[model samples]
Target: MTAPTTMPKFSKENSERRRIAKQARRLSLRVLIVCGAAETEKQYLEGVKGLYRNPAVAVKIKTRDKSPLEVVRYAAAFSKSDKDDFDEVWAVFDVDEFDIAEAVREAAKSNVNVAVSNPCFEFWLLLHFVNRRGHLNSYKQANALLCKHLRDYDKAQLDFANFQDKIDIACARAKDIDETREKPYANPSSGMWRVIGQISPGSHA
Candidate 1:
């Protein structure tokens, strides 16, 4: 007969201390990004990483199925897992039909962050090309606009390389939209820039 072993409890204090130490060593700031879909967000972050290529930052992206809530739940769980030690965890989701309040609440409780887009993430990408002034009600609508610029764009392809030069513009535009719009109804809005800024600290693009 074999006896079962108990898992060690995670200590936030210790985690914080280790994170600080890691930072001091000039090591990469470990970030875990959980996305709702398989490609778009993943490719975009990957491009961000490639663009910066900074020794001080590292981004790891994982994808989930359809639910934004489920992605948040996964982020919460991943943050506490013993196998990984991350400085921050973010859930990338879109505000479509799903009510994101619960996911946001749960993420707050678990110390997980969320980068959400209204309509869809493509709208966030579109911000790099166009300063959209109106509401985008669906992902398809956003995609159509984006397609005009990226004629061959497909959801499976990240194509962030094409927009790398315009990141600052996208950031500024996203900021403007966020500032001008109303809460929970801010169409064509995204909180992605906040996370992107953190991931690429000091690098404006």
Candidate 2:
């Protein structure tokens, strides 16, 4: 055998390629988050799931309707052998100013990593987030005035019948009670999160 040959440091190109590959590997995985809602609100869950489907993704799904609270209380993986469990935990929640309401104040104070969509976060899920690329105005009158914005066309074909016209008929009919509670936390890409609303296993969001 010949004497051992010395090797040079990694070429810049090779190092750069490795860096890019590492970044790609890091970003490849995703996670799932569950929200609470009414029985009729299962559509929200399905809608989110349909839009997001990646093999490397994890899920923090919270079932709503019949067992919304129960799911929150017991959706985590548990250990049953030798009083030991090294399983993964994947889910998170958030707290809002009003979430500090007298009823849930003590719980909120704990600063527990609550799901972002607690209290009225569910309403945003129903109205807007259901469609990734859609907008839902709060006021009925605004909906009517902004008819030009809706492409569905005609009062009969729209999501809500007589949408704005009906709102004009009743006071506060178009009031968005949760509008005040609809604060959006920063997404992972945005780098502006002092929040815990979006739950992802091994994720920074």
Candidate 3:
């Protein structure tokens, strides 16, 4: 009869190191953000990631110049295909002339989070400076309002530095609007604060 093979034993120090490594991996969170715009949203989110610089949180952004519904679908598919890779998946888009009902429904079905800025994303940026309750008719109108605060505001480029310190204030303002409004995605409202809260949990606003 063959002698029984003895199992190699791990030292206590080695076992402790293994346990710590597993714990660290468990603590880390990986996030994927799918944007409907090609530039501005990506720029702003990259800035948020840079500001936090949280070692345990990893953020990845993908841009698709598609409709909000399509963007949400893509994010959902990607999440499904690589479910193990990301702890959470988010879809960010504007309600600019597009019927966002389907997109919102899809996000809910796929368990994807959303950051929607009604009329335009600039409306969210505008909140960082001022809390205006007026309805925004179009992207141009929101951009114009944002320009009042960020004189050099441009859709092609974004300066995260301008909005960095004002994050808390912006979140508070957004929450106030959300609380008072009957519709969640009402004009001049933004769900961006929700995303910010997740990426930067320390945000009090």
Best candidate (score: lDDT): 3
lDDT of each: 0.83, 0.32, 0.87
Judged by lDDT relative to the true structure, which candidate is superior, 1 or 3? 3
Task: Name the Cα RMSD for model 2.
Answer: 13.4
lDDT of 1: 0.83
lDDT order of candidates, best first? 3, 1, 2
42-142 per-residue lDDT for model 1 (tens digits): 88888887887766666778888668889998987877783557888999999887888888888888888888998899988999999986877788899
Off by over 4 Å in 3: 1-23, 201-205
Model 3 residue 58 lDDT score: 66
Clashes of each: 0, 12, 0
**Better model by TM-score: candidate 1 vs candidate 3:** 3
Q: Over the stretch 1-205, how does candidate 2's per-residue lDDT look in tens digits?
A: 9998998777999999999976755655333333334331234333333443332443334443323333334333221121222123222332222332332232243222333332223223232212221232322432343444445433223343323232222212112232322443311011101111122123332
**In model 1, which regions exceed 4 Å deviation?**
1-27, 201-205
Top-TM-score candidate index: 3
TM-score of 3: 0.85
Q: Which scores better on lDDT, 2 or 3?
A: 3
Candidate 1: worst-modelled 10 consecutive residues by lDDT: 196-205
